[model samples]
Target: MDFASLMTKEISKAKPSDTKDKKETGSNNKYQRRADVEAARIAAYNAEQEKLQREREEKAALKRKHEEDELERRREREEKKRKLAEESRKKREAEEEAAERQRRKRLGLPELPPRASEEGTPVPEEEDIDDEELIKKLRELNEPATLFAETHKARLKRYRKLVKRSLTPQLSNGPIPTTLELVPEKDMKIPAKIPKDIDPESRKFLFRQLASYFTMLLEEWAIALAKRDTSVKESFSGRQAFNAMVQSRDNMRPLFKKFETGDIDHTVLEAIVEIVHCAQERRYVDANDGYLRLSIGKAAWPIGVTMVGIHERSAREKLHESDNKAHIMSDEVTRKYLQSIKRCLSFAQVRWPPDDLLQLMG
Candidate 1:
């Protein structure tokens, strides 16, 4: 019985040790499960972070591409606008230049380029270069080497012309040059000075208006003159004579009667004579008296007329009156006389009339 009881106690103690080992094993398994769950949660977080980062990078790349495309389009638009503006400017300039040329042509003046006078480049001298060198230079300037069998002297002249053309760039496109003599400004025609009381701008305006009026008168006279027959200019009954009377404001007979009766105003006669005198070129002679002497023109003169008094030299002198001369005039003489007056009036406006010479040149 005692042996059996001891064996039972030993078995009981062994059972307790086994129970403690099983409990320890269960605690270890619980700890392992918690570690595995934590690892899985951390891994899932890392994957989500990576996915978000990739999405953000893709969005940034798309935004940059859109911005670059927008910039490119904007640059293209600006370039097109600039080109159009440049073309418009060039077209306007060309049109203005053409109009200016036409105006100068009508004025019987040279068509000069814009700011031509500002270019002070000297013309190349022909004497400085030989023919071979000159030919090369001409080619460089896009000019012909020589004009049809031109002489050496002619070539030199041509070279000078080319040099002048190159230097000026704005040479006038005028008709054949006139043979009119160039008078010195101070010694030739003196411009009328502005009176102290006169407004300069107003005077200038009046002068321009008067000039325009004179141009109209010239056109009217030209139309009348065109009808005149060239063959019988000297005949009293010729078309030329008839047209001359027709050209006058009224028939000149009344004017002659007024002159004979000494009834015409001095200002009216002076104005008439002043207009006629413009046809003839005269120099300013400091020594001469105020009276301008008259010489008979090609027209047949009336009998026994020594001279026709024109300008009033002083207060006592009366011009364009028949008080001191023969009053008879045929249609032929009258025609030429009126024509001379018209010629004077037809002359262009000049800046040489004195301030005191009112209505003398307008």
Candidate 2:
């Protein structure tokens, strides 16, 4: 092969190699550009992902906070309801206790002395009284009617005259005498001035007869009170009705004062009043209309006494019932009753009688 031809072939070969090298370099450049673009796109995608992740985390935290807040609110509402229920339960029990105490008191049950087994028993650690000393004290206090026989006889005569005058039909229109005397049992004597119509047996009746009449009067008064009616009429003669009312008010002053000061419970007062009224009538009064009608005389007294006893027993039983069924009374009701009673006692001047007369009055 000629030298030119060899040179030409080498040139051609060189040209082909140069062209291939260029193509390869171009491809590498294009690849590098594509790689750069891809890198930039990847970086952008990564950054966007990071932002999206942050946003998702924030959303999850917000959801968690909202759920926590809702749970807290629900818990607070339940707690409030529980507290209200507890308070209501306590109030009801107090009212029931007050009512029971009043009923027992009104029925004339002996004022319940503190129990010996309770913390405040009055028993001494050792006995201090001797049988001999007790007998001496009793003997000293005793005195026979014989010591004043003559004075007693005169007094008895006067008492009989007074009683006769008081009971006489003619004297009914007149005012009752302020002072009264008692007749002695020994003076079974009829007065010289006794009416011709008077029987010897009737005249001989002593203070026992007067006591019986007084008991009858007491029964009548109790019946009137129970019925919420006055014994005296609007046009009745003299001030007897007024005087009786005044006396009742005076007797009940202590109780009224205690109620006013909130020292006494209202439930107790109401129960006592109801019991007394029922006992007086020898029957339960209609609570709705407040009506009571009782028969008069000796037989009624026994009935009244029996009814009073029943009331007292019922009151004691109620105390036990309340304790066993504590949930029955709502605390709110109990508190309301207590508060109402306190206000009524303080503002209203209602009378309450002495303990000694409670049984008789009923």
Q: Candidate 1 lDDT, tens digit per residue, 1-362?
A: 69999999999989988999999998887666778889999999999999999999999999999999999999999999999998998899788888888888999888765644435543467455677987887888888888898965677678878889767524211111112222222333213333446574543333333233333444455555556667665566676544543454343334434433445544334433333233223322210111122222223333554454975334233333443332123356544434444443333223233333343532
> How high a TM-score does candidate 1 get?
0.25
Candidate with top lDDT is: 1
The deviation in Å at residue 338 for candidate 1 is: 84
RMSD of each: 29.0, 33.5
The 10 consecutive residues of candidate 2 with the worst lDDT sum are 288-297
lDDT of each candidate versus the true structure = 0.51, 0.43
- Candidate 2 lDDT by residue in tens digits, 1-362: 99999999989888988999999998977666768889999999999999999999999999999999999999999999988887876566556656667777999766544325445444353533343443353345452222344443343344445557658633111112212233343332323222446564553342223322222333345454445444334436324544554354344434333432435432343343443333333332221112111111011122233344334643444434432332213344433333332222221112322344332322
TM-score, per-candidate, Cα-based:
0.25, 0.22
**How far is 278's C-alpha from truth in model 1 (Å)?**
80
